[model samples]
Target: MIRRTTAAKGLALAAVLSLGLAACSSDGGEAGGGETTDTNGNEETSAEPLTIGTILPVTGTLAFLGPPEIAGVGLAVEHINEAGGVLGNEVSVEWGDSGDTTDYSVANSTATDLINKGVSAVIGAASSGVSLAVVDTFAEAGVMQISPANTATDLSGYGPFFARTAPPDTVQGAALGSLILDGGHCRVGFLVQNEAYGTGLRDNVQQAVEAGGCEVVYGGTGGGQEFAPGETNFGAQVTDLLAQEPDAISIIAFEETVAIVNELVAQGWDFNGTTYFCDGNLSNYGDDFDPGTLEGVQGTLPGAQADEAFREELNTWYTENEGGELADYSYAAESYDATILAALAAVRGGATDGQTIADNIRAVSGSEGGTEVSTFEEGVAALEAGEEIRYVGQSGIGPLNEDNDPSSAFIGIYTYGADNTYTYERQIEGSI
Candidate 1:
């Protein structure tokens, strides 16, 4: 009985998908669908399944999100195949684990393998650092790369081939700062990992916090304290931030968040209550921490709360197929949407080639003038009828903004309950 709501509906910013049978593209035949030429003068494409590669964290700090994120792409594939597949064929996935940013070895190798395999797109690299590590590879190869959970503002200029369903941390950071000030916290301190994700978000939060007429006791001007990628010792970082005696604190870390939160408690700080978490560490620390330790803690993440029925369905699918409940739902909806949007763009552009998908991708995600559809089947049907579509996915994400990001999307404010986990408190909508 988890509580859920698409609360962004009341506050959504601008945003704006398609489907159909074999359609015409500049290419005589789409590589993913109908017929393609072989050097052997044969029209047979390889019997190997055409795949979408996923680079989710499976062995790293973000592994807690692996199950749900993996399941998300799985379910999207399920839905695509049911709609007669993308381009007259069933869709498949190439899965790879992104072992966080401390070492790019795993992500680099996995990305290379997926790229070499000719996947039309790569669907992850959830951490901003992880994504940046090889985003240039995809861009150089002209491949479409979509992220389900990347929010660092720096990624805005990563390139056209890179798109994300998750709004940038600029948006989430601002909202978080505004939320803090609105709550009357006049002095704030931030503890962040020293990485693209942490630093970028911290900078944005600092901007918003300062703009809201508050003082930032830590970070940049207050002497920003940064931790290494895999650094687990938080006692020093905690001491650094608390030395400022700030009224509120912000913790930006991955698995390391657990250690830091616990340490703050040991130091008798209202670390959980007056503290805030961004997407990087906004997860179910419920089972790992003592009951109610993280209760009343607040955080913000892109996208509105997903519909409960869809949540149940995704969980049911995972339970039956992968066993056990979907552990975390943080970026699951965005992951599903990223895969589906890529697939639909392929269909609409009438090819499974990366370049084609890239060119027509924005057509399915902008602010206005398209038929609105939710599921793959519905989008396909509309395209068959020769109608354009704008898909708002499970998380209530809107159309892509001018910069090829979810310009208009929701930033859900979440609060940990007595279970030491979180539920959506509300969704704020605006463009960043």
Candidate 2:
């Protein structure tokens, strides 16, 4: 679901079979919307408008993530406005680019700018590193910050004002471990980045594998690149992976995926026999590599694979409004849910400040005995009608536990195909 703006390997691609196979399948619950009015019965605004700002990457290494995430925000805004904007004030969005983690200044300045503008809540900074850089700023400013794609386990204890719709890497890693075992793979080796996201995930995956009486082939070998062009060589890392002689290798990286995959193939390693990837590099590789190079390759992404109908609808909307089709929808559902939760929190609290929304967020996302709703209009109406509302939207958000993370989630398992593209294979349902 992602594309990097880099050059491809020059080797002749394997002849593709069944190129563009059957459209991928997905999973998620659905609901309908109806008329809605604020609890105050006042459809008009008497207070300062509620402004939600986004720090998603519009021009960075993760810029490919921008379109779907940004579009998700836009769609939520449209839906919320149609349902009656939060607190009777028409909701509006302030846009800012989180140029990636290459520079903290860009993220810091942008976070400061959004805080200075008195944003009630913030939506992104897709990279966990980018979010970490500016999270404290948003927290100090008392603004609710939610990330759609950050999965680092370290972010679990972020302050009360911080939460994310996406589950942590711990959940994903453990699920992926179970997946490997279920697939008859026991000797899984991880060639992961040496950082919070990678280490956290690696630890979880190791724990799960070891718990299942399995062993990690190379449990501690760091495979991260220096994140620099020309210097971001993965030959040594690939050599290390081969040295471990792991039955399966799971790669965790960003733009460096191109080189790592190339190295694996160039060295005569079986490209699809035992290679795996995580969210950061689990993207459509139809252009980056040979046509059928990734056929039979597998990976895990953090959220549910959205259903085809919704995907088509989203792609259509994006083309009509945002200039192109949504190539990647990995975090789109989470982005939409995050925005909706923040707005619902504001509406429920009847205030527009961060702390108030923070206090009420969990309440609107009811944990027990609440009416299940999927849209803002339905949730708002349910709240007004004095019925407990539980919002299970596009991504199927589970209970936001006390740690501000999901108590349960659906980790999508995907498999690459003849065209170097992937389709959903199944889902691993997990919980605390």
Candidate 3:
């Protein structure tokens, strides 16, 4: 495989020195120990260690999602190691934080640190906009990047080494649009976050709604009804959105959703039963709002609901390792699936490099016909027996498409209760 490297700007001098020291300490083999055949048919030995890193949100607007995502990665690592590790060596992980778009420096620095640490692949940046900021860096360094929750439609086919476990907004948007129309809402409005994720989903939802014979009364793409990412005060935007007299309104944002809801209540708008939320803001609002403040509100989140067994496993692993109770299982399944897929790809390709993982990820995901397996141990065993194995992980996603997006996925519908918490109503499957 061809190797690529570029100078990472803005990194601290200590980090560069650390990289140099690590290089000096190398045992003269590939970062992960593996044997490669030369052009002359001679076998050469190299180190084969698969180091995975993470750029998940630990702080910022999306921090609420951090616990489950982090737990998912940790659980997957534990499983892979228990399955005798990857490439004959224990798999190691380096964790870093990917703050929201409000601060690109956090993700930028984290990406640099992970790359410098010689990670073969990264799982990361739940926010699509945050992923967009650092994807090029990972690509330039030949590191595979797989996001568990980035759903922006344009991110499909964005990079040869970039992939996501989450279905794009096309699936979630259609499901949400249908939900609104089915609720007898004829005039829909959107208060979007004015970013790749928000706008892309808004457009897809609008298309679905219009096709269903419902009119978008406000906040259509390019209508200038969007707000900045970190904008806290929503009085004017809420006033304008309410002025349109929309019966159904979707607030597509992150932490700012709390402020927007408060503004809506202050303006005498009945938020109950009329508000909608997307994955970016479908979190439990019990701590932020009064009881019954969000009663009857509905929202949509991508991915199939995790079953009880998997949830228990994740919670058990998290409490033991991270010392916390798992509050939500939003993208935990997706994150675990992403890690498992990468490990299976490494086993199939006989190496743990990013290019090898990228080349084999689709095949491991069942893009082509193979023996179906569901766990890391099963997949590794099948591959070792000279069988092509398809790894169907906890996330029940179909094979990877030509663009590296899931061919089909399930979108979960949820409704808020009187305590400002949401309960899963049902799941709708959509094919890209």
Best-fitting candidate, scored by lDDT? 3
lDDT of 1 by residue, 1-432 (tens): 111112223211321001000100111112434553322233444332346887887667777777677778878887787777875777766666676888799789878877886777888978989999989988887778999988888888567799998888778888988988877798898878888898888888889988887888876534756778787778877887789889888888898888887788888886456888888888876677778788778998888788788788788867765546876687889989999998877766666777767776777764545889989888877766677889878867778776778867789899998788888889999686
lDDT of each: 0.76, 0.74, 0.84
lDDT of 2: 0.74
TM-score of each: 0.87, 0.86, 0.90
lDDT of 1: 0.76
Query: Which stretch of 10 consecutive residues in model 3 shows the poorest summed lDDT?
Result: 20-29
Candidate with maximal TM-score: 3
- Full ranking by TM-score: 3, 1, 2
Candidate 1 or 2, higher TM-score? 1
C-alpha lDDT of residue 17 in model 1: 7
Candidate 2 lDDT, 1-432, residue by residue in tens: 111121223312331111111111111112222233344454532345677888887654566677788778777877887776775656777766676666668688779888887788999978888888889889889999988888988888688988888999878988878777777777877766655666777788878888899887774534343234222677776776688778777777766677878888888788665777778777777888878888888889888888887677667656755556777787888898899999988776666678867987777776654888888999888888877677888887687888888777889989899898888888877775
Off by over 4 Å in 1: 1-33, 36-49
Instruction: Please report how far candidate 3 places residue 1 from its true position, in Å.
Output: 31
How displaced is residue 185 in candidate 3, in Å?
0.2
